[model samples]
Target chain A: MNASSLPRWIDIGLLPVLNLIAALTVAGVIIAIIGENPFVAMGVMIKGAFVYDGALGYTLFYTTNFIFTGLAVAVAFHAMLFNIGGEGQAMIGGLGVGLVVLFLDSVLPPLLVVILAVPAAAAFGAVWGVIPGWLQARRGSHIVITTIMFNFIASSIMVWLLAGMLMAPGQMSPETRSFADGINLPLVYEVLQMAGFSVSRSPLNLSFVIALLACFGVWYLIWRTKLGYIIRATGHSERATIYAGHDPAKIIMLVMAISGALAGMMSLNEILGVQQRVILNFTSGYGFTGIAVALMGRNHPIGIVLASLLFGALYQGGAELDFEFQTITREMVLMIQGLIILFSGALAYLFMPAVVRIYSSLRKPTGSG
Target chain B: MADLWLQFVLTIDATLRVATPLILCAMAGLFSERSGIIDISLEGKMLMSAFAAASMAALTGSPLLGLAGGILVSVALSLIHGFACVTHKGNQVISGLAINILASGLTVTLGIALFAQGGQTPFLNKSERFTDIVLPFAEQAEHVPVLGTIYKEIISGHNLLVWVALFSVIVTGYVVFRTTFGLRLRAVGEKPEAVDSAGGSVSGLRFQAVIIAGVLCGIAGTYLSTAHGAGFIREMAAGKGYIALAALIFGKWRPVPALLACLMFGFMEALAARLQGVEIPVIGNISTDLILVLPYFLTVILLAGFIGKASPPRSIGVPYIKER
Candidate 1:
């Protein structure tokens, strides 16, 4: 069989693993050059990411943010659009959450505040996501360029609002005051205790469950629904989509709005669940990392979930590496992440020939038997 | 009236300095895009070259050597990009973004390892940097009106690199518009199949264009480290590479128009610098953050065709696959 006709298992599962191994090998070489044993560093990373107490919680906490952003990108990718504005979307979404909490935290019940905050965050992010989408659909602007520009605009707007309009009274830092406790999401550890299991107290909250639900929701939307069929059809070919009597422009706007809404959900995790306050730069490159997540996961919900978890491990484990080794700093971790992005994205088909060769050879023997 | 004139002169001077890297980078992008490659790796090349230049200037105390080092590093990155996009048929934008991410991480890692200053090199001595070259008779000519002020304030005291940037515009214009290679380059971007049928190698032309981009980006990076600033800092290129790309689009991917766009952006930057903390009527204290966002905001607006259509090359982002 040819490379393109490879089995789905190898295509989705084995190839990404091979690429991940290649990426890690290069990272290992760099680690060796930096005077650290790559094996030891790998062991430390794995342990820090999963085996240590409270590590899994933090990993999942970060995973929650990636899930939102990754799904956002995945949805947009299905419509042949690159939504690089997730960083900005998440920021504005946080603003939405913060606004809702700040206004109703003292007056409304906890459940009621959450009920209002979720939709508010999605609406704000959708607004941010749609402008670039609209420009691309109606005015012929490139989505990538416009989204990138909006990221900067979103950041500058946030800085101004945080430092000037939203600064807590009597505070010098550029962050709003924490909302009342009623608005805060319950921690996972508390829920686990309620279920009679002891667990480490960590920042993992209700948002993690919501993120899992979103994964299921996205899976259903993409494969089991007509809208997803139209989105995927548009991604395959705009001409065919137009021939099908669907307005490509409307589909683009719809896809981008959905992507933006998913990105906005990140604020519920980052702001209401953990920080309990809106702050500057809290998105912290999660939006960009989402692009990598979508790429590695092959722009599928299941793959995105797995890729998000892997990246979450890298993030938490990379931080552990920084804390443990002088030679392995945060930048080294970023180098590894970048290498993974390079391998998975630009060199996506680089190893396909080799994989196809091996698979064909294996199949020849099995078929004869 | 004279005070306002002096302010204008000074702003124009600052605009040139700020616009130097931007103009160089936009021209670099023009070469790559004009030859059918979407070069978003401009930022990566500039950052890596800036690191090389600063490190060399700091180590050896020769700004010229530093300049050479920067160019070499940038050229290497350009070759890598060509290998991925031209030879391997990879996605151009993904490759460019990967180069940027790789450059960002590698530079900081190397800087921390080499200098031990948390990703910053030691400060360069004034003797090791590209110092200003005051024009002949500039001091004496300052007595004359308008032209004298322009000569003295804007053109007389810029470093050698600034003059080189200005000269590059005419040179790039000639190379892209007048030369046979220029014809082949434009042909390759628009219709690679036609160029290939006409006995030209599409990949070869594209690779050459990428190399030119690398060299120009190197010069831009060198100027940033060795002339505009004292030494290398993490992310010293800032967002100038993307801004350069925006300027390229704003200028509709041409050399002369791109240069004009860069100057306009540079003027906006200089204006922002001057206007910080200065209050204006009706708006009441126009914040620096808003000004900082102006270039990107304008790019989006311009991109939306509020000004006019800014079309890219026909087959710019597509990888040219040869049939056997």
Candidate 2:
């Protein structure tokens, strides 16, 4: 039984679900080893992430960041480029947002400042992304190595800028001054209250809407556009893409640019909507987590959405675990996440051989009958 | 002139200390990449080793035991990576990334579980660490100028692991360039099928290379915790592993050149650390961030062919599937 012989639904959906189960089962064992009931932990996590009023909003807030980063990674995956520099690109994007807001906040209206900030962020991210793309295309430098290097360079750049030029005047921390109230993006709770829904206040903001739109945009671009066709072709085989009269280098650059832009947009959620100020290490590990999300999602936009939600639940629930349990700390949450990544990614097909055999056996009788 | 000499000596001393881990990591990367297994998990392996070494040193008050524990953990990780990628034919990069993520999380989790100092091990005493060894008659040597000063300043005082790290480079060079194992390892990386056809086991060679990487990275991690610092801190390896990867590439996967690259990075780092509060003629108090970014920028430049071309192993990152 071959991978291709598996039904599309099983290939796309069932396997991922099974992998999720495997990951969770492993996580359950770890929790058990920590002297905690896995079932109680799971229940607490699920309730904390979704069931409670304000918890949903917090979950969505995290989901928004993942959506952008996952999409970024997914787009790059289409071109066979591993943009591990999403963390760096997003950091630089936040810098762009910081520069734009710092200079334009007092000068322009809040609406116009936000309108300008989006493109500024995306453009900075695209530049950062394209450098490695250009290096790969022109110099034959491996994209993975260059991008990883860029992450460190980006960190140093952020630290330098935040501490020197962008620091709040007279402040010591590596963060910028807060934006004016008028310049701050409205929260989702505030917007919902305006609509009379009485939602709990959380950090969820307008960026969630942008994240959704970006997802749809990515789906349309990747599935419906000629450029995406070329990108996918290049990913399939550069020689085949070249035979088809497409420039693989151009496709690589374009794919990387779009991917970087998507990664950059994550700062809209972190900086403009939530913090209202640029800070050091604001991207946290969202950029790297995107790799796991993309892998689990199989690099499909719809799958990415589901994967993002799942991770968002984990993030929120993990926080709850830290707060509620004495034994299960935040690091334990990371351990669980790492286990999930390992199973879903490195061991993605660990169960596939068995599943394929089962499917073949089921179909054999059906066909004969 | 004396002040200049003192400054140079201090920079060289700092560079040696800083470059120790990088040298080990680059050699580790060289072994892995040469054998066609892209080991991005160098960081993870080092981190896990650092944590294990620190914890063991703290527990037993024996740096040697800590070093052994570190090596054991890293070898286990290396075997896991080999099992996944070499045996199951998993994605090499993904396996590496998964190891990294696992190490990042497990180290912290285990730290909290054991000592509960928010993911930090207790500091080791001087006796429990690989203390710096001073040369005999160093005070007498300091009385002499030039060569004696050089001996006193640059060569006399360094931890045993620093000497071990330096010696490992020569050993790595000889093993990689002069031995039958080196030839087979290189052959497996570039053309595994040819090696396999010639009665060499590709998986076996690759697994051995990975084990070598594990041992080297383990020593690097132990050096970080036991010799370079008092104990383990969260993410102490930081991006040094990645930097080592970059150095490996910049050196074109060669041991000597990679060691040079590591030294260059170490110098840049030493400069960055030393430049604090210092005013230059035109730059006038250069930002540490810019200085910090210099090594990566240099790596990028070197990788982009401004310095030299970096040709990776032909079959690197490709899983070797036995065609039966």
Interface RMSD of each candidate, angstroms, one decimal: 1.1, 1.4
TM-score of each: 0.97, 0.97
Clashes by residue pair, model 1: none
* Alpha-carbon DockQ of candidate 2: 0.66
Supply DockQ values for each candidate.
0.74, 0.66
Error of 1 at B73 (Å): 1.9
Q: What is the C-alpha lDDT of each candidate?
A: 0.90, 0.89
The parts of candidate 1 lying over 4 Å away from their true place are A361-369, B281-283
**Candidate 2 chain A least-lDDT 10 residues:** A327-336
Interface RMSD of 2: 1.4
Report the C-alpha lDDT of model 2 over A1-369, residue by residue, as the tens digit: 677877798888888888889878987886777578999999999998999879999999999999999999999999889888899999999989989999989988999999899888899899889999999988888899899899998898888878887889989898999986677668989988999989888999988899999989999998998877888889999998899998899888888888888888889999988898999999998998888889999998888888999989888888898888876776666777777777788778888889988878877876841
